[model samples]
Structure formats: C-alpha cells, structure tokens
Target: MKLSAETLADLHPEISRPAYDRSKVTAGILHVGLGNFHRAHQAIYIDDLLARGGSEEWGILGAGVMPADAQMRDGLKAQDCLYTVLEQDASGDKGRVIGSMTDFAPVSPNHEGILRAMASPSIRIVSLTVTEGGYFVSAETGGFNPDHPAIQADIANPGKPGTIFGAIVEGLRARREAGMVPFTVMSCDNVPHNGEVTRAAVLGIARGQDASLADWIDDKVAFPNGMVDRITPATTEARINHLREAFGLEDARPVFCEPFRQWVLEDKFTDGRPALEEVGVQFVPDVTPYEHMKIRILNGGHAMIAYPGALLGLTYAHDAMAHPLVRGFLEKVETTEVIPIVPPVPDTSLTAYFELIEERFANPRVEDTLSRLCLDGSNRQPKFIVPSAADCLKAGRSIDGLALASALWCRYCFGEGEHHEEIPPNDPSWDRLKEASRVARDNPAAWLQMSDIYGDVGQSPLFREGFTKALNALWENGTEATLQAYLND
Candidate 1:
C-alpha cells in the first residue's frame, strides 16, 4: 500500500521494520540550508547518533534562507521530514531512513519564527550548508563583500534580515539580549578555513549594525573550522529509482552518495552540542592538515579535470576519470606540483590519499557530474588550484599541467567546443572573463591582470610564460593535444 500523506507508515519497513515514534525526537540544532550534501553527511551522522541511543538532544530543525530552500522544505515536509539515505560502496549500496530532522521553517514566511527558534535555550548549535557563494564572499579576495546588495539590505534591516549572515547575527543578538549564550556556528561548506570565513562574514555584517554585538559574537560564539568530504551528486529521477529498487521504498528527497563520509571539526561548542564524536565525527584541536590535504589534493584535482573533462565532452566525473588523458593530466598536476606544497596530513599517507581519491573517482555509481565540478571556476580556482600553481612558479618549477587546466577553463568560458557546449552560466563575472579571455589570446597578461583572481602570480614571469604557453597550445593544438604534450613533457 502506498503511504498516506501524514505518517509515512509505509516507509516503516524500510526504516528498519521496527515501529518507532518519530515525535519522540526534539529539535536542538537549526541547519540553515537543506541541501543534498547535508542530508547525506550531517543528518546521517545525527541518525547514527540517535541509533546509538544518545544525543536525543541533537535533532535537526532544517530551515531554508531563500526561495530555493522552499522546494527542499516542501519535499522533506511531504516525506514527513524523513528520507532514505542510500550509501554506495565498492561492496554495494546500503539504505537507511534519516529521521533526525524534526521540523522546517521557511525563512520567507517564518523569518521571525527562525529567529525565535534560534534565540531559544533549546537550540545549541546553528549549522550551515549554505554553499561558499551564499556567504556573499568576494570571489577574488575571499572576504565578505560589504557592497553586495544583500549585505547592504541585511545591514539596514537587521530585524528582518535577508542574507544568512544577517539572519545569524540577528539571531545571536536576540539570544544575547535574552541572556542565552550563543551557539556554535558550524559551517559544513567546502572552503579553506571555512569557520574563519564564516566568522568574518557574520562579523562583517554585524559590525555595520552594532559594534558591541560584533564584539560579543567574537567573545562568545564558537566558529569551528571543519573539513567535511563526501561525493553526493544532484539527485535525479534515475537516482530515485535506484534507491527505490534497493530499499523497496520510495522517498522523494532521498540522498544517494558514496559510502565514504568524513567530518573533522574543532571540539569547541559554547552553548551545548551533540555527542557527534560518538558517531564518527573527529573533534580535533586543528583541522588544518586535513583541510589543506583535501582542499589542495581532491578539490584541486577536481578543478584540474573539470574544465578539461568538460572540454573533452565527458559528462560525469567517473567518465572523465576513465579517460586516459584526463586521468593522466590530474595525476601529473597533483603528484608533481600540488602535493609538494601541502604540508603532510596526519595519520594518512598522501600517496594513499591520492590512490583513494582515484578509487573514489572511479565509482561509476556515484555519478558526480563533471559540469558541476566545473561550475564556479572563478571562485574555485583561487582556493582549489591557484595556490599550488603560484607556489610552483615561485619555486622555479614547471606548471605545464596547471596552465593547461586554466586555459581549458578559459576556453570553456568561450561557450564553444567539441561538445558544441554553450557554457553554462557560472560566476557573476563570466562576461568579463569571456571578454578578457578573447582579448587574452594575443595578450596573455590581460586575463592574469585580475589582481583579485591571480594576485602576485599575475606579475610572475614564470606563471605568465606557463599560462601563455598552455593557452596558446590549447588555442593551436586544442585540449587533447595539449594533454598529450603535458603527458609527454
């Protein structure tokens, strides 16, 4: 029998075949964005926490800060805020229904409701999955963009704020006035020093409203740096069918992801927090090594393949990884250049990590889209690809592969190629990048001159030579030939 709308009783068998009271749970954390990754990672951790018969204090209250959030809110709400999470591995796929998220508040209608919930003594941690761009950080500088219209609107209207940071700052102010200690602002996004970036954004918005509140936030709120990794792609209808076939149940918002999941967080929580460490969360004094390792290696390698793979007409990341040329290009860049700049990761061999990365990329079932990886190249390049390129240049080393990656991205922005691919709209500055790249065919310095994007690397003779060389090669011989050249060089 199909499940009734209210109680997902039909899902009971799939949720362990044991009847349990969902209402027994209470909300303790308010997650700002209800994205696919969060459902696969953080919510899954909380599910494990509940399974261990502890931290019943840490149920998640999912909230959406924008109109895009409404769809997720409605989907989760329709499923009774319960969805199946399918974890895939080399062995096979396993399934579970994550019932940890208890409630939903769409920020548009319930903006005040969100603030009240946040200000309550019950809510201890405010976590976020708002993508890096949602932070309104300047893509070039990695700082909060005060001039952003959203930032300005949020600053002027603190009570009914529009942006995530504004909502957070307003909530904190309410909590402070109510004699409630602030909660940890946990950022689950994939960015270097994500916690620090989050703190800057909150403070940047708050300082414009009230100086004392900003100072209080610094003194009281705990912004913990975290490194979270998982390969969860956008869920499609095919994915939904796969989940139903595997689990013998239907869930509209089910999250299908690779079995691998890791969350390394700073063990600093002010108000109160979950015993998530019990459920495989590594609470560390510093997550820098892991952060650096993932950022530079996995994410950096992702940036490397994205443009080139997109250029090659490969759609999924696994397909791209399967190609000899794209695979070789990624390995060359990562092993020869990128890894050298990364400090050694703890208790993990960087070599083993790369091997594991290859294995992960080879997982066809995950279906991570190459185009998704290529999106937001403007922001992703500096964080994921540029640092290593700059370091290699400074050390008087060759960046033949790195230069090729950048040129592929530049070519991608041109909106034409073997795929007849109209460049998907990415980055607010795409028009400028396209114009500059068009002009840069003759003047390589034209694209490099963006101080916000390239920094001092633009002025370096080595980077200029490398960029010019690779870009010219791509223009002349194209991506495949350029890859062959780098492989042979």
Candidate 2:
C-alpha cells in the first residue's frame, strides 16, 4: 500500500503517535532544495522530536527553487508530505516513516509563494541544503558573483525571483516592511563557512537592490555556520522496490542513506528555533574547527579516492577501499598530508576519525558510488583537496600523494580509455575541462592556466610538476602500475 499515516501506524505498532494526528503537530520551518539529505537528516531529527511529545514548533515547509526539485514536490504532495527514510549501514538497514514536512511551495515557477513563505512569521528558521554550487560564488575570489547571469536576472527582476538568494532577500525585505522579526538562516550543506557564504550571497544581492535593506539584514539576521554530514545517495527504482518489499509500503520518494548522521551548528538563531539540541543536535559557539576537520578529512578523502577509483574502473567507494592500493593511498594521503594541515577536531582523535572513515567507506550496504563522489571535479577539487595540498606545500612538506590524486582526476576527466565506458556528464563545465585535459597531456602548463577552476594550484610549480609526472605515469603505465609506484614511494 502507498505510505500514509494510517499505513505507517499499522506497520509500526509501537509508535505512540497516531498517524492521523502527526500532521497537526507541525510548525513551519522553510526548507530550500528539498533533496534526500535534508529529508534524511533534518526531517528525521524533527520527526524524532515530535515522536517524544516534545515539538510542535518545527515542521518543515518544503520549498524547491530548481526544476529538479519539482519531482520531489510532486512526490511529497502525493503522500501528504510524508515519506520514508531508510538508513543502511554495515550493521543492517532500517526504515523510518518521516512526517515532519507539512506543506509544499513549488518555487520553480511560483516565486511569490516562496517569498511569502519565507516572510511568514511562522517560518522562524529558513534552512537550506542548496549544494555548494548554488551559492554562485567566484571560485577564484571565494566571494559572491554578482556578475553571474542568474544574479543579474534576479537583480533585474527582484519581485519575480529566479534565485534562492533573490528569494531570501525579497523575503527579508518583506519582513522588514511588515515590522516582523528576521528569520535565522541555517545552512546544512558541506561547504566551509556555509552560513557566511549564504549571508554574502543573500546580502550581496540585497545590496545591489537596496543598500539600506542589506545593512538591515547584516545587523539583524543570523546565518549560523553548520557542519552537516550524512551519506544519502540518490534514490533509484530498485531502492523503491526494496523499501516496498521490506516494509509493505509503496513510497515513491523514500530516502536511502548510511546510518551515520551529524549536524554541528554555530549557536545563532533569531526568531526562535527547534529544540533540536534537545534531540541530539550540537550547538556550538564556533563551527569553524569542526567544519574544517570534516570538510578536509571526510569530504576531502572522498575526493582523493573518487577519481583514482573511477579511472581504475572501480564502481563503489568500499570496493575501491577494498583494493590495497586505493586503501593505502587513502591512508597515506589522509594521515600523512591531509590531517596534519587541518586544525584540531573536537573531542576526538584523528586516528579514530580515520578509522571511522575507513569503516564508513567499507560499509557495502550503503554502496556509495565512486562516480557520485567524482562529479563536478572542477568544483569539488578546489574546496576539498587543493587547500590541503596548498597547506602541505606551505609547510615545506610533500604532497606527492595528493598530486597523484589530482593527476588521476585529470586522467578521469579525459572521459575515455580502453574500457570505452562513457563518463556521465555531471559538471557544468565538463566540456571545457575535457578539452583542456586533452591539451594538458601534451602541455601540462595549459591545464593549470585555467585560473577560474584550479586557482593557485594551477600555477604552482609543485602542482604542475607533480600533476605532469602523475598524469604521464598513469597514461603510459596504467592505473595499477601508477598506483604501485606511488605506494612504493
């Protein structure tokens, strides 16, 4: 049967809340980019709070600013805004029906609805999961790009919004006009200083439209930096079938994720937020150290493995980790190069962190695909890997392993090999990157010249020499031999 409150109550007899009454206890918390990660992490936490008779203050009001999110909006609306989240880990898999999302404002076309929702006093916390790219940042300057066509369009037609930042600014403007308190903007993406980044994006657009409003937002709004981690892979038909068979429910948008979930936020919310702290959320004075640690270690390690594994024709992260060379590369690069550069992580040992990462990678049940990690290499590498390489270089240390990792990326971007497996198009700049790599093999200097993508790494003699060497070896000797050489070194 299709999943609903009654169906859920019947399937999970022990749940204390009657399925029908679950919707009545929700309050509005506007959520952008209603993707799998938000559904699994934040929605689940709020659902747990409601389950304990603790919250009627934080129900998610789902909003989607992109065309891709239209499907999610339709699926959630079909099920009364309720869906299942299946947690898969090494231990096993368990399904929980999440009911914390109350309503949907399809923002792809209905820009007015989004602005109204955000301005609503009921929406005390405006949370986002709009991946790193959505911020429209100039990767070179690490700042907002006002010259972007989308930003230009949004600024030109402020009343009819086209971007999330535009929508946020319009909402904040309305709140100010109506004499209402400003909403707290919480970023749940994996980018560093996500809150500050978002604030810049929002305020950057607002300043172009109205400088006074921008100043008002700067003074009144709370953009809490956050560290959010959960490995929720994109859902497929096979997963839907698995959920149906496992739980006797035909939920179309059931989320599948690893059992691990973590959220660390800077404690700054203005309009009163969820008692999420009561249900295991970590509210800290500063999220920078934790952010750096996770971004560099966990996310950076994923990038380190993705390209190398993909070129070697390995499909999943665990499978890649199972290979001795891939595992060793991960260990050497992470422990030797990556971790030393990162500031201390809170309350935990780096050894233990690496151990946990290895275990997570080895969880075959999650099937974290290498290609998933490999997507948008141009965007991912600068944030995830290049900084570590830079830090090591500044310290007069070797990043030979890191360089090899990057060379593997350059090879992967070539998009073809003897196997003839077509690399799926994932990057907005894929065509340019592919063409650039083709020329780069003959003249490594040509590739590094793309200042937009590679930044200082492109021009660095260290990166150039290391990249040229690694690329040449991999091209001439193949993945296994290149790996062996790196390992022996």
**Which one is best on TM-score?**
2
Alpha-carbon RMSD, each predicted model: 2.2, 1.7
Model 1 score (lDDT): 0.82
Across residues 1-489, which tens digit of lDDT does each residue of candidate 1 receive? 222235455554544421335567788899888889999999888888877775677889999877777887787787678777777766777776778888898658437767878887888889998875667666466577888897898888879787778889999998889887788899999988899989998998999999999999999999999999998988899888876665567776878899899999998888768888888999899999999999889998888877888888888988899999999999988889888878987788999999999999889888889878877777788778777788788787777777777778877877677656576666667888888878887876788887777777777787778889988888889889989999998
Query: What TM-score would candidate 2 get against the native?
Result: 0.96
lDDT digits (tens) for residues 188-234 of candidate 2: 88888999999989988898898999999999999999999888887
229 Cα displacement, candidate 2 (Å): 0.5
Q: Which stretches of candidate 2 lie over 4 Å from their true place?
A: 12-20
For model 1, name the residue pairs that clash: none
- Pairs that collide, model 2: none
Clashes of each: 0, 0
